[model samples]
Target chain A: MELLVFLIFAFLAVAAALVVVAHKNPVYSTMALVFTLFSVAVLFILLGAPFIGVLQVLIYTGAIVVLFLFVIMLLNIGREDSQIAGHKAQLFFALLGAVSFGSLVILALSSLRPKVLAPLTPELVSLKALASTLFNEFLLPFEIIGLLLTVAVIGATVAARRPTAEESAATAAERSIETKEARP
Target chain B: MNVDVVVTVAKIAVVLGLLLQVAPIMVWVERRGSAMMQDRPGPNRLGPFGLFQALADAVKFLFKEDVTPAAADKPLYLMAPALALLPAFTTSVVIPWGPNFTWDGKEYAFTVSNADTGVLLFLALASLGVYSLVMAGYASNNKFSLLGSIRASAQLISYELAMTVAVLAVIIPVGSFHLTDVVAYQRTNTWNCLLQPFGFLVFCIAAFAETNRLPFDLPEAESELVAGFHTEYSAMRFAAFFQAEYTSMAALSALGCTLFLGGWSLPWLNYEGMGWLGVALGLGTLLAKVGVCMFVFVWVRWTFPRFRYDQLMRLGWKFLLPVALLNLIAVSAMTLAGWL
Candidate 1:
């Protein structure tokens, strides 16, 4: 039963991932990306990582993808330009990058044993055990990641802050001048 | 195995049946309660105390013509209402309706799916709830609908941060994300509302925003946005959005009851000692608590004036987020000091 479900979702994830890249509309591509993420989450649950699965959905599909959708709609992003196909050299470089990344992943996986890779033991993936492992063994990396996220958030806030009073006044003056010119 | 499947099916049936009933009945309450507050007769002409008013509205919704805009994205337009209802139905399954009971020598949990990641599951669904509004607005091909959805997306996402952290304030001391653990913790330590009033306050306020109730309901502010995301919808489609709103209100209220109000664990009510009678008694208590929450939802809506868009954003981010974080820290400190 588990294998069957895994196969179904694995196929779904692959198809959705393809759609994410290939879809013409950016908004539709984001929706397809949600499907891919959700399928991956289901795969995580199948692997006895329900906590990770839920987090995957919570963080990726729920939060990040929603933001992506918001931007796509707010900007009214249109279909992908067909002119991208004109760049053969760029396409060659992209394939070269993809191949190198795939090879690197394969090389990393080759050194790991199957049992070591995914133990599939409930104890390993359970919330308490995961928390202990993260805090004890991976605490530095986790804290560093948290710090990185905080810094990024602060940067974003600083970048998106309201313009100064003079800046707004200048813009208002510019709009008034443009309006006056159009009226004449 | 057969019994397990049967029990799950039964639990789903009961939860869905009760949840679906909450929508129509709450609409009745909203109308009648608002009318009573204003010294009016309300919809008493339909049936006994206007009991059948919801039914009449449902019938009218079903018969009304389902209109689709010429430029609307057809598939998404059709899917939005169903999407809206999905979270409402799914989030309630983790909520324990009554205490566990043994029948036929087999123990059965009151909830439908008592998964280990129950709270996380609820949060995931809560995060996705905005999609329906976004989809509705984006697909509608109408400016108002699009703007409403944009506001909804931002508002829900912002409030979700505060709500999730506020919930964690309670869950931190409990040391588990399980709903049953929450109820059990409350049973031992008077209700959580008394213990962490700040958490409760932040949670209730965030819950109001999460469910997009009034004061925070800028997404569908009728005067400004002309019915918001569902402006282009009509007939049963519009009804679906309306029902989704009420159903979600019921879900969030039930969640609040579980999180803060001791769930089915009523004060001076020892259903646990009542032997087999605890099952029915526990369910009754929970329903009653949920009923009170529902009334509160209506009352707050009628009582509060809607907040301006920036004010709503400011409240969610500047006020609620910081307060929820403080509550989390306080609770964590108390837990560490063996106070909680």
Candidate 2:
């Protein structure tokens, strides 16, 4: 049953990934990306990472992709504008990159010993265990990453701050003068 | 089939039926409830006391023309309503509607799927609920719809952070994410609402925003956005969004009940070990709690005016988020001190 479920979702994930790249409309591509994310989430759940799986859907599909869709809608980019400028070259490079990545992954996996590993027990994937490992064993790295994220957020806010009052007024006057000049 | 499988199937059927039935009942309740508050008769033209008003509305929606706008994204437009409705209906699977009952020498839980990750699953599905609104707005190809969708995404994302923190506050004390375990903890101790009152308040406010109820309902501000993200939807498609809204309202109420209201447990009353009677009483208690919460939802909608977009954002981020974080810290400290 698990194998069957995995097969179905794996197929869906690949199909969705293909659609994400192949679809002409950006909105449709984004929707396909959602499907890919969802299928990957299901695969995670099947692999006994329920928490990660749910987080995948929660954070990626739910939050990140929604923002992507929001921007896509806000901009309302036409199909012609969204299409790749160098379509053939881009596809060729993408295929070459994918093949190299696949081969690299296969080589890495092949280097590992083919010993039979213990089955993933429920306790191993449980949130309690995951939380303990994350907080206790990897606390320093986690805290550092969190601090880095906070710094990044602060930097972004500072960078995106609105223009000062005088600058805004000057720009407004300039825009008004331009409009007035063009009106005739 | 095993008894577990059979029981689960039965539970799923019952839960789905109850959810489906509640949507219509809520529609009637909202109409009549609002009318009472407004001192006006509403929807009384249908069956006796307008009890059949929801049914009539359903029939009307079914018969109305399903118009697909020329400029709209056809597939996404058609898919949006169902997408919106899916999360609301599916999120109820984890809520324990009643205590376990021993029948035919086997214990059966009332919930459809009592997974260990129940709380996380609920949160995930609830977050995904935004997709429906966003898709509906964008696919409609209307400025109002797009604005509404944008508001919805922003509002939902902001409030969800506070909601998650508040839930974490409850979870810290219970030390579990399973809905049944949370209820079990409350059964032995005080309800989380009494323990974490501020967290409960934040959660309630966040729930209001998350479900897009009044005051925080900037996405669907009829006066401003003309029905918001669903501006272009009509007929049953429109009804689907309506059903999804009420269903999520019910689901959120159920979550609140489970987390803070001691679920099916009545205060000072132990319903366990009494077999079928206990289960029945527990189910009734849970239903009553959910009903009260739903009534509060409807009451707030009519009593309070909608907040400005800025105020809504301020309430979510500046006020609720900070307070919720503080509540979490306090709760965590208390738990660590072994006071909880």
Candidate 3:
């Protein structure tokens, strides 16, 4: 039963990822990305990491993908804009890069010892256990990441702040001059 | 094993049937209830006191033409309604309706899936509910629909933060993400609402927004957006959106009851260890609580005027989010200090 579930979701994930890249419309691609994220989340649940699985759906599909769709629609990127500008050479290089990455992953897996792994016990993936480990063992890295995110948010706010009064007035004056020039 | 499978199947059928039936009935209730509040008669001609009005509406919707606009994205236009409906059905699976009861010397739970990660699953599914509106709006190839969907996405995203924080506040006292555990915790102590009134208020407001009920129904503000995201939808597709909204309302009510109103537990009564009778009574209590919550939903809809778009955004971000965060911190502190 577990294997069947895993296979189904794995197939779905790969298929959806393909659709994400192959779809002509950016909106379709974004929707396909949501599908891929959901399938991957199911795979996470199957692996006994239900918290992580839910987080994947919550953060990626629910939040990030919605933001992606928002930006896509906000910019009104039509089918013409969605089309890739490159030719056969770009496709060839992309395929080569993908093949090399696959081979590298395969090689890494093959080098690992062929020993029977311990089965997932409920305690191993329980929320309490996961929380404890995350807070205790990985506390430093977690806090650092949190700090980095705060810094990034601050930087973004500063970057996107409104122009100064002088700057805005100057821009308004320039726009009026351009409009007057065009009126003639 | 066969009996277990049969029982499980039967349970699923019954729960789903109840949910599907209740959503339409709730629609009727909302209409009638709103009419009563406004001192006007509403939908009295369809059936006895207009009870079967929803059924008639369903029949009408089924026969209506399923129109797909020429400029609309065909596949997405078709899929949006189903996407909208799926989360409501899926999220209900984890809600425990009653306590376990022994039948023929075998114990069975009232819930479909009593997973430990129930609360998280509910939140995850509820968050995905945004997709339906977004897809519908974007696919319609209409400006109003697109604007409505953008509002919906923004509204949902903003309100979800406050909702999650409020839920976290409730979780602190219970110290468990499982709905059953939360209920069980409340069985001995007071309801979370009594303990965390601010959290409950925040959650209730956020739930209203989450379900897109008035006065938070800015996404479908008819005065401006002309029916919002479903402007281009017709026939069963439109019905699907309608049904999904009611189902989410039901789901959120059930969730709120479970989290803050003590689920199936009645005050000053022990329903456990009494077998089938207890199970039945527990289920009744939970349903009654949910029904009351549903009534409150209707009452609030008729009483409050819809918020302006900017006002709605400000209320969610500036007001609710900070209060919810503070509630979370206070609850956490109390829990750590052994005060809760």
Find the candidate with the highest DockQ and give its number. 1
Instruction: Give a tens-digit lDDT track for model 2, residues B1-340.
Output: 6777778788889888889988899999999999999999999988899999999888999999999999998888999999988999999999998888876788777788877788989999889899889889988989999999988988888899899999989999788888999999998898988988999999999999999999888999999999999999999999999999999999999999999999999778988878878988998999899999999999999999999999999899899999999999999999999999
Candidate 2's C-alpha runs over 4 A off are A87-111, A163-184
How would you encode candidate 1's per-residue C-alpha lDDT over B244-292 as one tens digit per residue? Answer: 8888888888889999999988876677767568978888888899899
For all predicted structures, in order, the TM-scores are: 0.92, 0.92, 0.91
Give the alpha carbon lDDT tens digit for every residue of A1-184 in model 1.
9989999999999999998888777767887898899999999988778888999999999999898888888887656542266688988999999999999999999987756465456676678999999999999999999999999999999899999999999999999999999995
Measured against the true two-chain complex, the DockQ scores of the candidates, in the order shown, are 0.65, 0.55, 0.57
Query: What's model 1's overall lDDT?
Result: 0.89
lDDT tens string, model 3, A97-120?
999999999999999998998787
Off by over 4 Å in 1: A80-100, A114-120, A163-184
Evaluated at residue A92, the lDDT of candidate 2 is 93
lDDT of 1 at A160: 97
Ranking the candidates on TM-score from highest down gives 1, 2, 3
Better by TM-score, candidate 2 or 1: 1
| Residue A67 lDDT, candidate 1, scale 0-100 | 88
Tell me the spans in candidate 3 whose CA falls farther than 4 Å from its real position: A87-117, A163-184
